[model samples]
Target: MTDPDPQPWLRLDPRMLLVHPAREVVRFLPVLVGILVAGGASGAGPWGLLGVGIPVALGLVRYLTTSYRITGGRVELRRGLVQRHLLSAAIDRVRTVDLTATLAHRVLGLATVVIGTGSVAADADEQLELDGLPREQAAALRVQLLQSGAAAADDAALPSGTPPVPVVRFAPRWLWYAPFTSGGLVAAGALIGVLSQTTELFAVRIDVTEDDLSALTGLAVLGGAVALVALVVLLAVAGYWVVNAGFSLTHDGGAWHVRRGLLTTRETSLDETRVAGVTRGEPAALRLAHGARLSAIVTGLARSGESGAVLVPPAPRDTVADAASVVLGTPAPMTAPLRAHGPEATRRRYVRALAGSAPVVLVLVGAVVAGASPALLVVAALAIGAALALAWDRARSLGHTLVEQFVVARSGSLRRRRDALATGHVIGWTFRDTWFQRRVGLVTVDATTAGGQGRITVPDVRVGDAIELADAATPGLVAPFLRLGSDA
Candidate 1:
């Protein structure tokens, strides 16, 4: 067998000339503005021209120099302005192909094609991105890359009567859980930070006089607080709605296809064979609301913030469970009752929780004893109550279970997560125990794999149970060491 001849180098869509410069300009706009403002204030004009000229020059250089092509069973990219560099990956190694279009790209009918082989190396070699291609071409290229090499051979064609099944779709009710998650708060903080930076640069003023607060009555103040809370919730819900608008997760052609976003659209295809596990996350607020978030544990895929790896946004726990079942090919591991770590683990959780809040509790108690306001006593009581609640939650969250070929670990209080990993994908095992854990005969077992976060930890399990779990997950891997120990 012989590899095909190399294909001719292909340039990015010429339309990128328009998009790239605009992007570069926006990226360096602050510097450009500073240069212009300084030059005007200092009675010099040349610096302003230089600032404006550099980004445009770089954009032009990038558009002219960047080129890529598929050939000889490899996807190759040659891109550099000052230093020539080449990056290539075997077609069989490709794990994901993502197509994205910003508002600008959409307007110009172009998309950025990102080809990922799931490299966890330095960021520079993580993926090959062609900034702009005609939307149709980008889509075609995504298909070609995903359906090439071993992927094509492994990808069985859909049955004649079977169509792609939609596992999850964005729903209006899901937005209710959005506000409970930290998404709104984070977005609000980021928006404020950007506005602060840009407004300060422009000497913009946002006036809120002390007189305004002084004039408010008790009812008015209460109403204002309520309004502020409502605003934050609204912001969070709106942000999630826009970013996840039209979101859908579907399985077809031996890949998981995720389509999402509104103003800046994205489509990602992930090879099903690379999926190793599924994570069901329930943040404190989301859990109270009975909602969960789902994401795939895929080999070599870097966790892209928010948009990356996620199969379903915050939705009903049932919905998340259904999605996880679809991805994992089984529901028992996800839905079955987890095996608790027993009384010792529960005691540890309470001790840790109380220890964390002890300092504040002591401070408040001392204040009340020193003739301070009796309100300090109430605060101390509240602190103790909160710690107890947290301890109970954490204890409840600690559990691990094994079902068939999947090993499930669930833990954490504030951000509880249940990870169901395929034992077949388990590559290694790690056992860790602190002095306290050793005293209690509890060990934390880490199931290391090539997928997801690379390790799934089942914390505070009995030493015997941890060893048994490890041995069960991968037969004979742990038993030999145990036999040696027994013989010794």
Candidate 2:
């Protein structure tokens, strides 16, 4: 027997040519320059016309060449010219399908749909990218691929299907977390870079010089720095509002829909079955400010990027808890009272923190005594005190518990984190024992998974107790390798 022919591929939209040129003009700057030179050298003759016509003519060729298909069993993409590229992946291997759009694409009613396989490589070759699809069509494709799972492949060619129920939506008040998100510094720097690039690209000149800096006094410089920092904070707050203004999360038809962004307007969906766990991020600043965020631990999302499909962004703790419970069908465990590790753990943490701060203390004190900046002494002392206090707080935060179908782990002090993970979704168990940890009879048990941060670590627990907790969380998942009475 032989495999049957695949379904016909859907041709790419002609608008793709426009979208490509809009985003990729920088890539083809050399081509544009060549055409300009040809035009200037040859005037309005055949060469000038050819020079003006090359981009549009070639863009149409490439646009017509590109196409994609969603067969019953596989997703395929074919594009390229002198060196053609083709991609095909079994529908079952599809781990995630994200719909992304920049401001331009949103205006054009287009989106880029990315299909990911649960691989760790940065290149993500196993993924297929379908660029410039109508937004509605992309959403339908996501539903079809996810509903099929990897176990089977069948085209459920249908309409956009039913929408999900709204679980959470951002309020204008949530913008309070924006400045604290990065203290506004990052957003400010990004805006400055963009402005610089734009002006230099267009050959514009600013009305400032080194003479301006030379004219400023010490107090003036300090004032400038303060002003710049404030500006940055404002930019960050505005950026947050722009991106998360209408953010919402909802559930329907066995998947989670994440819709957010103002100018770019993105719609990302995740298969409910693929949710490995949920994470609660409660930074000290944000927590004190009465804010928290919730994230779903799903397969093939960004492993190291900030805000990688966060389920809830900067909301009250209660709101985040409610949203998590509703969307994940778990208890949320946001209010799980942590059980602290013993005094020995706290002692170890204190000693480590003090030891780490010793060098800085010595250097700064010595510098002040040796007639360097006396202000350094105060800064160093404050830093050491903060570190010591943070270590104590971190020790208090080290706690974990297995609550029915969830394993709750809490750790950190500067920025506290609480993980509520589904026991069954845990792929493996790793017991980490350092020389210090072994001497103290403490171990860190990390529950490995295919999504989120890749693992949820239960730190600073008694060795025997750790094993029991892991075992109870997922029976037989951690028992086989343990020998309680002897070191196995």
* TM-score of each model, paired residue for residue: 0.90, 0.86
- Candidate 1 residue 149 Cα shift, in angstroms, is 4.8
What would you estimate as the lDDT of candidate 2? Answer: 0.77
lDDT tens per residue, model 1, 1-488: 12566579999999999988888999999998899889999989888889988999989999999999888878899999778878888878988888899999999999999887877664764458888999989977876777773457653643335556688888888888889889888887887788899999999988878997688789998998898788789889989988888889988766888889989999888888788898889888999899999888887775653256788888999999898888899899888998999999999999999999999999988888898999888888889899999999999999998897899999998998999999988999988888899888998999998866788999999988898899999998888788653331
Q: Which lDDT values do the candidates have, in the order given? A: 0.86, 0.77
Deviation of model 1 at 241, angstroms = 1.4
Segments of candidate 1 deviating more than 4 angstroms = 1-4, 28-57, 122-126, 158-163, 194-214, 303-307, 483-488
Clashes of each: 0, 1
Instruction: Highest TM-score: give the candidate number.
Output: 1
For residues 267-379, write the lDDT of model 2, one tens digit per residue. 66676677777888888877887888888888666575335457888778878889877865766466667667788778888988988888889989998899998889888
